[model samples]
Each structure stands twice: as structure tokens, then as C-alpha cells.
Target: MSNAIDFISAYNTIDSRLRAIYRGKGNLQFSDLVRRCAEFNNTVRKYEDDLLLCARLRNVIVHESKKDRIIAEPCDDLTRLIGHVAELLSMPPRLSVLREKNVTGIDAEATLAEALVRIAQTNYSNLPVYRKDRMIGILNNRRVVRVVGQALERGEDVDVFLQTPCSQILQAEDMNRFYRVLGRSDTVQEAIDAFEDNRKLLAVVVTESGDAGDRIVNLLTSADIPMLIRILEE
Candidate 1:
């Protein structure tokens, strides 16, 4: 009912969740748990200072109090802040907020010229390339630039190269390092982690089951990182 009670309840919830996260490990201190989880959990890392301070405040509220006597009460704002942190840790915001309707996919065999025209017309810098209904790679400006730069260096007919197939150009693009697959159910935090973990990642394709072969339901590019971060911080 009181701010102190509300604060303690949310703090306990966060504590329990942290223990569950590292279940089977030896009993650990709350500060230690927060520190260790921060290494892998972006939410924890983002609010590390606040959580640690709350832990200390929690000790004073409980340990320093006498029977039937409250020593200190947390402010209403602090109570609500902890409550929000608990809710986020329990159920993070999913990628649905970033979902794009009518995602366009390009045929792998489409010529570079056609792809460029589509890119220019649609204003979509990244387009998934598919062959036989299976996604092979993405067509992005960086890939096009690289191909054109190489053509000019060799004095090869740039027009001839523009006639090359999207699939052909994809072969020279580093497929393994440029993209990742995530399920539609994945949270925004996971998407942020995917981009953070791979500096070279160009895009994240979301599908029904996180398989590259599945039809893409949503796509996230580096351009969306700032927006995602804002969502989390907000």
C-alpha cells in the first residue's frame, strides 16, 4: 500500500527473476547477481546503477528498521521506476513495434539494373534476395558500391556488370557475417543484442521460425538502431 512496500515488492520480484536466470548456480549476493547478469543482459546493463542503488536502499529499508517501525520510505517516483524495471525484465518489448508492412523481396536472378531501379523507386536501401522461395541474401547500397568500384578499377564495362544477376553479386558479398535470422517472437532487446554483437551485421530478417528459408515478416537494419535504443530507454 505504501511506497516502501511497493518498492520492496518490485525489488523482490527482480531479485527472484535474477536467481531464476542463474538457477543451479550457488547462492549469490544481489549485487553480484546484478553485476554478472549485466554482462549479458542489456536491460540490466542499462539500469545497472539504478538497480545497485536500489539494492543498497533496500538493505537500509529492511535491515535498519525496527518491528512496527518504518525507518525510511522511497519516493513515489523511485517506487514506480523500480516497478517499470521489473516489468521490462519479466516481459521485454517485442520487435512488433519495428515491424514493417509489405516488405519487398527481390528475385535473385533480377539484374543489377532492375534491382537499382527498384531500390530507387521504393526507397528501401535493403531488399531481401530470394531464389525458389528461399531467401539467399540482401541487396543493399554497400554491396552495389563494392561491385561498381571493382568494375571501375578493372576498367570493365560498368554497364556489362550492371547486367549481372543479383545472385551473382551476392556470391562475392560475405553472407555469413552480414545478416542474422530472428523469430517474429523475438524481443527488441534481442534485436539490439544481435546488432551489438556483430559489428558487420547489415540487417536482421525476422521470420515465423527464425529460419532463413522462411518468408520474412520483418526486417531491421543498422539505421533502426537509434530508434530501438530510444524505445528501450524510454
Candidate 2:
């Protein structure tokens, strides 16, 4: 069959399989349901082996039909289509279990010298800076290194070459403010939103109940949030 035909057929098969599973093709015999697993799996496997569908099938199964009203179990077909959600489920957070040499700080001026030191010491391209419990800016390793060389050649004080604080660099005239902060007790999802959407990677991790949001117990860097999420999600 043509690529387009095969593509349509695959989607139809997924839809048909879901309809059969949930729409009560009225509860087949247990033995018959087991047989259905083999037949459905074989059908899905054929499409999975196709050149175009091999990779595309994974994405389709994952993203498509998510909101569709259907109840399906961990059948062989699903295993063939998705290939063990358990594998991805088990991937440890790249953030947690990562080295924590990058220590905590506040109002920390990111002189090029200091930024360079942190990058070299931590072997990370990004360094989080803070100003007395407030996240100030990220010291990018590449930029800091490049700007330091240029400043030094001119006999300039590299410390004076610090980039403007992150708020200044990322000020949003149109975007509304996000006062949505995490108390030390807040769920990790809050941290993820701040990191991904708010662009506040080195954002403040606050404690609300204690000191009534005045105290800063921890810092939530982009690195830390993802590490936590990897553990939670998988």
C-alpha cells in the first residue's frame, strides 16, 4: 500500500482497537480477549516495522488519542506500539543525583573571575546567582569567558563586566508578573512551571509558612527542578 494509505490505516487501526476495547464490543470471552491481544499486536507490529511508521508510530501513540475517551489495558498491542512505558519511567532524574558542588549564595556579584571559577570548578555552563534570597541572574560560562578575554585585553576590570541582573535582561513589558512562588512545602510542579514558562531557572525557592514568605530556605535552579521531575515523572 502507499504511504498515505498505510498512515490512514494505522490510525484507523488504533481507533478501531480503542473502540473495541472500551465501547463494549461487549466483553468477549477471556480466551477470546487473549486471542485479540495477539491479533491486534500483530497488526500493530506490521505498521511498526514500516520505514515511515517505525519512528512515527511511537510519537503518534504517545501524543495522539490521549484525551479520547477509552479504557485500555497493558496489552501486547500497546506494548508493541509504545514499547514499555516502564523503560522511560525508570530513567533517573538527571538533576537529582547530579553533583551539588554549586553552593548556595545571596546578592552574589557575578564578576567574570568568579563566574569563570564556578564554571571550571562545577564543570557546568550555567551558574545561579542571588541577591539576599532573590535570584539575580545566570552567569553563562561561554559568555563570561568570551567577555572576560575582551575586557582583559583592554586592561579593563573584569569584575565591572558583569552582565545586568537576569530581571533586567529578561524584563517583560507585556507579560504579567508571576508572584506564584513555592513555599518549601509546595509541590515540585510549581518549580517546573517557573523554570520552563517563567524562564526563571535560578528562581527563588521560598518558604511561606515559616517567616510568612520572608525566609528563603532553598533555591530552585532549572537543573534542580528537572532532576526532581525526572524522579517524579518516570
Candidate 3:
């Protein structure tokens, strides 16, 4: 009975928060509000199954007759469920404003040598390429090396390759293969989905609200996801 009371209390808290969230959006019923919450955020969507189960449990407790003094005993699963819902309601970190490592970028007009030097200094493989405010592409070490190798094979002077403009080596095919851009408001799950959907996708650039024309505010590489998962777990 104590566990059931605690579970009911947690469920009510979640339900009230949900109602407050959707109150101004539209005249949605409780069920519709829950659906909309899942639709609006990928993180919330991840907990959809567990949330729905909580909803059913809420219904059972709220509708119980006055004569029923006892309710279902809570298990470890109930404790976990309450904790997860609380975390979700609190709004997990946003990729746009994450306080992780600073994102570094290079100019499209920068010399190949400049980009190489930056890579060596930062040890960051993925670098966003921008021309002023516009993002042109991402420069990865593999592609940069490949371009230099092709130039050397043609008997071109090493100095010529070093002085070449970064954009000159950026093929249209490479941009499509290596990079994707997401909005600032997009959840981390969206970033994960982008990486999973594109096997060759090496990085995701978070722009102002996910637009390519906006300034790159954050960068997520395949390696960053595991770190992000660890942060979320904590």
C-alpha cells in the first residue's frame, strides 16, 4: 500500500506537469496531450512505452472505489519508472546549449596547410567548413589526406598542395557523404538517428535551429555519442 501510494503520487506529479505543458498549445484531452508530448520531443518519445504504462496505472488508482483500502504493491520497476519520468519532465540537456568541449571550425578559404595545422593542434578530426556565416562542408583528415595524395601522384609540388584553398578539395560527393546539420532545438536522439541513418555520416553540426545557413554552434561526432550517453545516464 505504501508503494502504491508513492507510485500514485509520482504519477500525479507527471500528469500535472504534462497538463501544464499542453495547456496553452491546444485544447487537447489527456490522451491527446500525452501523444503530443511524445511527438514534440525525441527524448520524450524514447520513454513513450514506459509513460503509457504509467498512464494506465494512473487510471487504475484514480478510478478505484472508496471501499478498496489496498492497492498494488510497487516493485523495483515502479521506482525506476518514477525516476525516469522525473528526469524526462525536467528536460534533459539540449545539444544546442551543451557545455561540452568548444566546437572548432575552419574557413573554406583557409589554406590546406592551415587546416592541417589546426587539426594537429586540436586533435579533432571533424572540422566544420564555413565561408563567413555559411557552412560549406566538413573537413575530415582522411579526405584531406586523400586530396593531398592525389595531388602528389600527379607530380604536383608539395607546396602547391599546402597552399591550395580548402574548398577546392571539398567535393560535392564528400559533403553528402560525411556531414549533416541539425537545428539547435533538436534533441540528442535526432543526432543519433542522423548518424545511424547514414553509415558514412561522420559528424552533425548544430546550427541555429538546425538550418545550414545559420552559424555552427555545436558539433557531434560518432565518438561524441557514447560520451553523451554517459552524461545522460548520470
Could you give the C-alpha RMSD of every candidate to the true structure, in order shown?
Answer: 3.5, 14.2, 6.4
Positional deviation of residue 201's Cα in model 2 after best superposition, in angstroms:
4.4
TM-score of each: 0.78, 0.33, 0.65
Relative to the unseen true structure, what is the Cα RMSD of model 2? Answer: 14.2
Give per-residue CA lDDT, model 3, range 53-144, as digits (tens): 77777677667625556554557787567767766666655676566456787899999999999999999998778897687877889888
Question: Judged by lDDT, which candidate is best?
Answer: 1
The TM-score that candidate 3 achieves is: 0.65
User: Top model by TM-score, which number?
Assistant: 1
Alpha-carbon runs more than 4 Å astray in model 2: 1-102, 106-111, 124-181, 198-216, 221-227, 230-234
Assess each prediction's global lDDT (C-alpha) against the native. 0.86, 0.44, 0.74
Residue 103 lDDT, candidate 1, scale 0-100: 78
Sort by TM-score, top down from the best: 1, 3, 2
How many steric overlaps does candidate 1 have? 0
lDDT of 2 by residue, 6-99 (tens): 4444444444453453344565543344344434332222333332333354344445635552222233453444333222212312222333
lDDT of 1 at 69: 88
How much is the lDDT of residue 97 in candidate 1?
A: 65
* Ranked by lDDT, top first: 1, 3, 2
